[model samples]
Target: MESRDYMNLSTDKAFPKLLNPGESLLMSLKVIKFNKRNKAQERTIALTSTSLLNLKGKKLQRRMDITSLGGITRSKHGDEFVLHSPSEYDYRFGSPLKDQAIQTLCQAFKNLTGRTLYVWESNEISLKDLTTTKSDKKKGLNKMPAPETAINFRGEVPNFNEESKDSRGKRSRTIFAATENPSAALLDDFTILKVLGRGSFGKVMLVRRKDNGQLYAMKSLRKDALLESDQVEHTKTEKLILQHINHPFLVKLEYAFATSTKIYFVMEFMKGGELFYHLREAKRFPEDRARFYAAQVGLGLGHLHEQNIVYRDLKPENVLMDEFGNVYLSDFGMAKMLGENGSTQTFVGTPEYVAPEIISCAGHNITADWWSFGVLIYEMIVGIPPFYDQNVNLMYELIQRGKLKFPVKSPVSDNAKDIITKLLDRDPTRRLGAQGFNEIKNHPFFAPIDWVALEAKRLPTPFTPRITDPLQAENFDREFTDEAPTDSVIPENKLNMILQNQEQFQAFH
Candidate 1:
């Protein structure tokens, strides 16, 4: 297709509105609907100003709100497309004019939502990309080239053990009996001090416990938003993991309680702030400093693995530092407990650090975390992810290719490069730490690290944050700390919504 084909395609002058009042038909094309259980049926897909309508002859089969769409994914060949919805099943469609269809949808979506409709390389879209807006255009959203890379196939590994037990040898529960009343008293234990960070689900705040007068980082999540995004189970998993795991390099959960409209997690406040902030300020860390941080994180991952849990999301942002500069792995929302000798097929993780197995839709285990570890090591020393590209699709292609290259100016040590290359191996079975994290700890790069001392956090850190006050969050982003620290008032009408779904979060305490 020519570039001009996508121009002026957002107007309804060329197509009439269909199915809805005041909705203009942006594009109409014949597509083959691929169903796993049923045969591929021919259908007409109409992209309107407000919704995407799938029609079989004169009957409408499905109508998806354009605003509800998470993103779009195109097959390596321009013959198939997948419409991703945040709250619904992905709709797969095949068409000879797939390129035209994608362009039309992107243009129309951008025009209607005032946001760029990202064309993901795979169906596993990152939550970060799903919530991105046009303000991220400079980061190169919606700028992928036509599909040309060959798709690699891997057999799906089935996990026979469906559920895993906790340290007490009891099956984990998603919803438990309420241990505390859902009232204002739930939050009265902690005095809100400062806003630490904010996200789609809720915000993290610095708080002081009224009973002990100890400071903590309280993460508050909205119940309605959790139900809307279908993340109730993941939230429960995070709570379960936090309650069981204890390590010097892992953030500890001090308390967990929920109100009628929100769930709260009180954790040890890492005064040194996110490693991302420090890394950005320093531009890049020296090999010695990077090794110091990597060793702690490796131990944290090792502990989680020993408990049969996988820390799938490991990045600089998720790694926080204490006042003494010791790093701790935070955020267990993406972490999961796998059964013995079992793997999961869930596609979740930051795109830059995602493993090749995850991108291929093959089952993945703890080894996936090793791949992210390698990416983090490379990024720490080189100042950017090795496979990073402005275009996300091209980045994924580079990741699958598994080519290792060092920057010409960055003087990475031979040992560092060796460990990174071994971890970035395309085959998960051959990847470093596949057998165990002992292999990683014994690597020549980490030879200087004293495992015993590091695990106990007795080793001196390379950097220590200058914290002037225990209550001040000078190391955190000012954008968040400057905001009001009060919890949002729930509307009287929304109280009914919270009551209706109270059972879903009964065990949250």
Candidate 2:
């Protein structure tokens, strides 16, 4: 394919108009790449390039420095560059000059330590059955793309189902807020106070916004790990779920942002720390204490269920306590919004709390949460899960058997046992609240607790953590918080494994 020289396209809007298939736009740009190195690690320099092309069949061959991008934004509209549309799409080319030009700039982007470089359509449809006017004449719109590839841009296809939620077919409205247009603040906008938690690929940092003095727990994910483990989809799902769900007992995701090597999740910081930390230290909660926590979590889970969501991971570690001891379910890595009639066969969740059906390879639903809730209540009062074991294989065997034998020495109440028994029923269909949470709520075990008052947080909690200051880090393990502060580094891969797959994680925020 060859480039065309006819230039009569409209230039008023940010994108192109109906110029048909063969027209080309002229664009002049400086192509450059960033060879950003892990400052924490000493390594040989790696180069990355991005190419920007002028559709005029001329290549911009200058290796522009990356650091001085001051005029780059201005040049986009300077009688040269053709601005792309807001929604992303592949610009398939007969000759691919636009695609080739863009790819060349990307190829030229190299040397993160220096900047030589690099930086980064609509219509409607006419449903005339062409057989009458077009097919007979053959000179009208018959020359357009084949009907199979005729999906022109006309905004988004509307879903008019009764239970459709937002544009994503969820069962809720306005689930995503300003997340679509995220906060302009960068990682430097916050002052890192201390490390709150750490994962194999990243860490959660307690940070205070320098502008407003607002405190938020930022979960940082390493780009390398995300691509290497093939977890880009999982990461995107977690981010989207956090943006979609809103409830009192659910942890709020304020903002999410991404950089070249890391993606950060800014969240409301829960001061009281992990329920597991409290559970481990306290050894066990009293019946009333356990009841309060369980009831609060029940509301959180119930809210998710109402939204047709399933909280696959419901362990104590993922449930956090605020200063008031009000619990909010966190970590949606395993949580998903299953539509009105959706179910998955994927095995997820903590082993000890995983439902029997999941292990049995039988499809499961919200009932899995009730089973986990039973394990949660048991562990809260008894200080350990029923299926506790050093061996994971043994744990799976026990989980499959689906047995719960309360310890004889423990003082777990009979009412509690009754509720746990109903929840942990091997038969998921017969499980408490398998049909609805009312069965669990109306149980005698929760007879004394007021569900409405509990949700309003009016009922006094059985425990409240002692948090004196915003910078407190005692709630997290010393092993994590004590690790000398890191500068958000990922081990460099010389084999190009992580870098090649980085496309999956682009533009998270």
Candidate 3:
């Protein structure tokens, strides 16, 4: 082959190649040995091209840099080169460049010299001696070494030895025992600094474990409050849900303990603040920043679905941000696992975010989670829910009708609008769930994200909140607690009154 056309060598510049079908070229690489002078001492090795094509200069510049793909560096002795190829170009381990670029150059040497090359490509192998050697030497390379272990594989019979100890162990426990009291265990060990957030049946406190001095959020629920309110089942369900889910993006339940009066759940302390605070204060997230948070929430939802758990609650208030601005799904009070062919019948969830199926009291499953996810996405971008009404019943009716009226002046992209439209489909069957999220990750709006890598948090978030320093937080903490009644001032009797008489407290229920 002509050096100009075959090598595609243009002056001193090198470019990758293209080739016509069935055409091949031989490459004569001068692997010259160098001494102290940086000049060739001796030797040259030749390799035939398996494929070749010349790319236009501009196109070649865009190709991924493969220099780090693994190739020989200068030898310590300076007598020989390291003899390797870029990992991207190589497929087989030691078959040489003729077959694939990654193979060891030693194989090429053996092929050229009509001598055998023995390299331990891996620690173990097996070989059967042929009654006679084959004339094709290339075929001989695919043999086994002295037998250290043998594994026989035949079609139908399954093997028992391959099972893992973990796989063989008892199935993972998905639920914790429900208790009438969780307060004694949680309160006796921690000093309640202040109440962070409170629900009708439970209260989350910013507390420090006295023994370890470790700060935590202690969620305390009076057994009488939960039971008298007929929310015991839901509370138990939340504990079970938290016990089953262990993911980075979801709030972790450190432990659950109870006293005769109340149940207490220890959870991770989120110091950065709340998603609601960010959204309300910032007005709305910029496109890229919103995408980052949305992607993370999608991942957390995906994990929940994989474990058959549905996070019925998906609102900015239910999501907490850590110091690094990582969103963690916090409240799982309404979460439930859909058993095979099972669904939830309760009509529960935040009115603006609940799905039509949920409001209708039709059996609902994980798809309800996606509907709320859509509402959340809209709120993140527009600074308001898509279907908001001052009247709670009207809001549910609007959501049931699946009417999402976007503000004409809103700056959201059409791609996002399209995704939200589909995700909020009244028919749960058509709403975005696991498969739908995959489509979303590929949308042009998120084209820049390395989806697999982003899911792993290998990439950094484009927007992070500016949070108070730990020391400043300490000062804020003191002021924040001053607004609420002192923990000691409530006294046992007054605390019981607040706990048992839900309607009596105007601010609470």
- Per-model lDDT: 0.73, 0.60, 0.54
Choose 1 or 2, whichever is better by TM-score: 1
Candidate 1 lDDT tens digits, 276-305 = 878877878999999999999998999999
Q: State TM-scores per candidate.
A: 0.69, 0.63, 0.58
Question: Mind giving the per-residue lDDT tens digits that candidate 2 earns over 222-263?
Answer: 776555334576677788778888888999998888877888
* Best-first order by TM-score: 1, 2, 3
Candidate 2 lDDT for residue 36: 19
Worst 10 residues of 3 by lDDT: 123-132
lDDT of 2: 0.60
Candidate 2 residue 321 C-alpha distance from true site, Å: 0.7
Q: Tell me the lDDT of candidate 1.
A: 0.73
Give the candidate number with the greatest TM-score. Answer: 1
Q: Give the Cα error of residue 463 in candidate 2, in Å.
A: 1.1
Count the clashes in each prediction.
0, 32, 18
